[model samples]
Target: MDFETSDKVKLLQEQIERFMVKYVYPAEAVAKQEIEASGDPHHEPKVMLDIRAKTRELGLWNLFLPDPEHGAGLTNLEYSPLCEIMGRSPLGARAFNCNAPDTGNMEIMAEFGTPEQKEKWLQPLLDGEIRSCFSMTEPEVSGADPTGLQTRAVRDGDEWVINGHKWFTSGAIGARFAIVMVVTDPDAAPHQRASQIIVPTDTPGFNLIRAISVMGSTHGGGHCEIRYDDCRVPVENLLGPEHGGFMIAQARLGPGRIHHCMRAIGMAERAFEIMCRYANTRVAFGGPIGEKQFVQEWIATSRMEIDQARLLTLYTAWKMDIYGKQVARQEISMIKVVVPNMLMNVLDRAIQCLGSLGISDDTPVAAMWREGRSLRIADGPDEVHKMVIARRELKRFA
Candidate 1:
């Protein structure tokens, strides 16, 4: 897999590292103060705008997309390391306009949108002038099995009427629009029944129920609960082919899953650094905590696990580049199940090492821990990925 960083990626990686240190890490405190002062969890802080401007100026904008005209034109393998660097800070990805839901949404538009759709939505998103969300999960069904989705979209004259409920629509609070998945052909093949449509946030009958909190915290442009009560949009808003939502979704998630893993490796790396720093300097029982055998073991184990996970992620990315997403499904599923669990373990140990300080907001550890916990179920649960892996493996011997 050539496991080596190319000259191009190395230069980009160096720029990203410096930017995180000089801008993003420092802005964390400012962002928190702004969010607190506004009393809005979904508030877009001024500091974020400043950071976004700086990132665009530095030519770091749209690094996640592969389209040369819209993005940096880097392949999955080339983008992996840069993504990991962004993972270190919570605000890192957004600063460069490489954040989730947006990245995936942009990919869909670039790959499937009509010229008009691209002009209306994709351009502003690429310019960082707007944000977006993906609404697929529901309150009554397991999101892992999307074929069971209950949302309905019925054709009515020149517009389509959509009616359904969705939650965990991440980044919906202030988004300009949403890429919604709804059932267009209930009696068709299960996988072929759903279709994706774009609905503007301002459309009538489209209700923002609330910004649903995760682990008691509602992040900016929160994971939301939304209802489309006969919300209507022009037929031109339909994304991709009719009854092709499942295929489009899988394509969107393939790269999205790898990006999540890449960022997770960075998160784990940050936690390990925090744990080691705390253990080596903090005095306990007349000596540093590093003197304790268990603490030393934790440090060693964290280093080993982080390295292993990173390599696996890189290999999966390389495979995707060489063989395409379909051929790399097994590898993708492997990392999907592996990386988040590794992050959770590393975060737990870091929290333990920091003692009481870790659980508090004094450090990023607690928030990171919460994020890692949610990731286990976010893209797809661990069990579902595991099932994919097992079924693939079983096919070999059969």
Candidate 2:
């Protein structure tokens, strides 16, 4: 197990890190100001578009997708470190067009979309001309279990009419279309009961209720509430085979987890740096706070936790690259549970070290904490992943 990155990947790492320092970090405040000035919390910031053009100019775009034609064609292991750098600043992912919901959406579409779907929806998304969302989690169902999804789509002639209330339809507000997971056959097996359908946001019955505030902010393309009231789309809009929503969604989640965990590590690393910088410069007890045992312990523990999470995440990426996502299921579940919680631990310590400023939005640490709090619940909750990890372990013993 050689751990060295290839020269190509090493070059990408250097470019992305340099890009972060020069462009993304400075654009953070500009993004915030643009959003504020727009009078719409969910407005697409001008800085986002500016940096995207710059990122394209630098040949740093679409580093997430593994497809050679549309993306950088890098393997999962190669993409992991780059994603961590993008996760450091909140603006980082969009600047590189590697943002989520979009990344996962692009993956599934590139694999399953018909040629027309690719031309109409996928290309624009790939070119950064439009954004899209995934509509799976429903307001009425427990999000942890996708089997309990309640949305319904019934075939009527050439159209599939859809009806449901979905919240956390992430990125829905500005999306051009939604890849909707709906029940096509109620009596079919749980996994086969649903299918994914593409519905243009302008379709008559699709309603954007509002962006549900998380941790007191609804910035960017917010996590939106959408009611699909007898929404109709061409039957040809179905993605993949009939009853394939579960499979497609599962595929999206498997690799996407690696991206999420890496980004969490990046955020934690930034917070860790902020915490240590404060400890070195901020005097307490007639000396630097770094001299204190408690502060030192926080620093030491955070260092260990961050490195552990990164190694485990990178291992999971390597396993996915070497074997496949199915083969790496246990490790995937483990990191899905481990990394986000590890991030919270590191962020909590950093926040405590910085005291009031850590809780304030003046620094990115507080916002990272606010957003990272949801990581524990998103994708799959820790309890759910823990249950999965234990079941696989018990089966091994059995």
Candidate 3:
């Protein structure tokens, strides 16, 4: 694959790096303090708003959507590197309006939403005026198996009533709306039995129960458990087709997984840098940890894994760009498994190398660890992706 980046992409990447150093990374501590003080997990600190404003002013906003009229109009391959640069800091994606749930939701709307739907929802989303969420996972059942979903949506007159319990509904607490999956026809084929409907967070029967923490941090816009007790939405809220939710979910998730991989690599790179810095500055016994053999080995290994993951992700992006998401499913699944696993290992080593400080938020390693670990379960989970890869290979051999 020709991985040569254009001058425009390179210049944008350099500009993003400068932006990260000057504003994004520095705002991390300030954002944390604001969240803690406000006692709101969804608190967008003023500093974050300023960064977002600056990002929008510089025309760096909504860089993830591939639609020219809606977003920056860059393809997946072009956006991949930009996303990786944003992934350097936890707040990076939000600064550019390129963060998760929102990105996937925006793509869905851009691709499938009707003109009115796009005008109402997609416009606000692209503008970053309001955030959104995806609710597909259930409190019960293996969420990885989309066919096993139990949330039900039934049509009643001009409205659709949704009933289900959903957890790990990422960004639900802060999201103004959600594109939710519900079974409209369970007797139909497993893959075609469900539908997607937009549920406003303020809908009468829809409930946001509480934020669920991963690795003990509830302030990082924690995953939420939500209940929809006959939550009714207008039939106009239906996205795509009646039994088309599963297909749309699949479409949304493929690119979504790539974005996750890109950001995870950036986080790992940051962790590796921190690990090396700590090794150089922290003296042990008579010399710096960098002088020690085992520490050097860890640093070396981190470099190797980071490089490998980045290459794999780039190849996946390239494949998607040239061959389309469906044709590149295997490569995408491969990185779906590789990127997080690589980052998890690198982060764990970095944590160990940092001693006790790494396990705490005193450094971003701890938060990075939490996020990277959760990724193993997010998207499709490692085992599921492995199954996809193995099946694809076995089919080819057969």
Candidate 4:
């Protein structure tokens, strides 16, 4: 229950805030122009590279990983606030090498990979020399229930041949490799039928089918659809134990969900600021919009909702730090559903407050709004999280 900020975390948070203000926020516009000019939604703009360099120089790189040997040695509680700051800008997380798929992939490697596997893939990912993607969702199955995934990985002498169609493979376009989930034991228990394996993007039969659009915009490093038709990797590439994919995936998502919630809170905070500023300054019906009771109510409700979501998220991070991911599953599921819905509401009011400008690209609200909407689906849909929470609560009563 003690969520007090440590001195090291406080210093790091201040440094991250300063970095965001000076570099990340400013670079957003430059990165947008570069991506637009390149005519590719997934293009990694040169300006982003510069920002990454600056983040490294400031020692803000890899803030997400808790491994002392490879990362900042910060706990989930400590990293929570830093994640919120980065969430303020879409480019914020990547600039510091704390972005998703990479973060989750790195954790899996550190926790489960063989030494050789770590040397080849994990090291490059940690160094930010390469990027990665997680391919778990399938086109034919309901993504919410990963146990129903149909991707197959069959043993073939020294190699594992993988055949699957995966979509919503985030960050696949620029990723050098993918952490793929495949059904290796179709006859095994449903929960233990699949295993995770590392598939190099260059491996034979591995294909990046296309980058799927979200809310009409495919942001850089777009979510992708991938086909692995007889894709092969060495036997040593299996992540964790055989038929252990479900366990690894659950572990990966615990922190990932928290990271998403933290960023959503930051996005909501930014939207709230914009909404309040616009309402205070804009004239409506011969008076400032802030003077109206309805506008004031939106501002008040937004502030309350943002703080509520933030406190819940921080509390969850603290629980994960104090207890373990397993013990904090209920809280994780709770925030996964609560924070995104809260964010959507806040963003909607912000958009309404800004009038026509809110829905346009002239401001970041529209883009953030779209991202907020996607948060409901990504990292396990809201319905799935709700089911988890309900099951856990029912077990308590039983």
* lDDT by residue for model 4 (49-132), tens: 998988888789999998899898988888889899999999988999999989999998999999999999999999899999
**lDDT of candidate model 3 versus the reference:** 0.90
Identify the superior model by lDDT, candidate 1 or candidate 3.
1
| Number of colliding residue pairs in model 2 | 0
After superposing candidate 3, which stretches have Cα over 4 Å from the reference? Answer: none
Clashing pairs in 4: none
TM-score for each of the candidates = 0.99, 0.99, 0.98, 0.98
| Model 3 agreement with the true structure over 1-398: per-residue lDDT tens digits | 77898888888898899999999999999998988899777787889989999999999989887788888878788888899989989999999999998999999998889998898888998888988999999978898887899999999999999999999888887678999999999899999899999998999988889998776677545689999998989999999989999899988988999999999999998999999999999998999989999998999988999999999899888889888999999999999999999999999999999998888789999888888888999998899899989999999999
Writing each residue's lDDT as its tens digit, candidate 2 over 44-127 gives 888879889999998999999998977899999999889999999998888999998899999999989999998899999999
Q: What stretches of model 1 exceed 4 Å from their correct place? A: none
- What ranges in model 4 sit over 4 Å off? none
Q: Rank the candidates by lDDT, best first.
A: 1, 2, 4, 3
Once model 3 is optimally superposed onto the true structure by TM-score, how far is the C-alpha of residue 387 displaced, in angstroms? 1.0
Best by lDDT: 1
- C-alpha RMSD values across all candidates: 0.7, 0.8, 1.0, 1.0
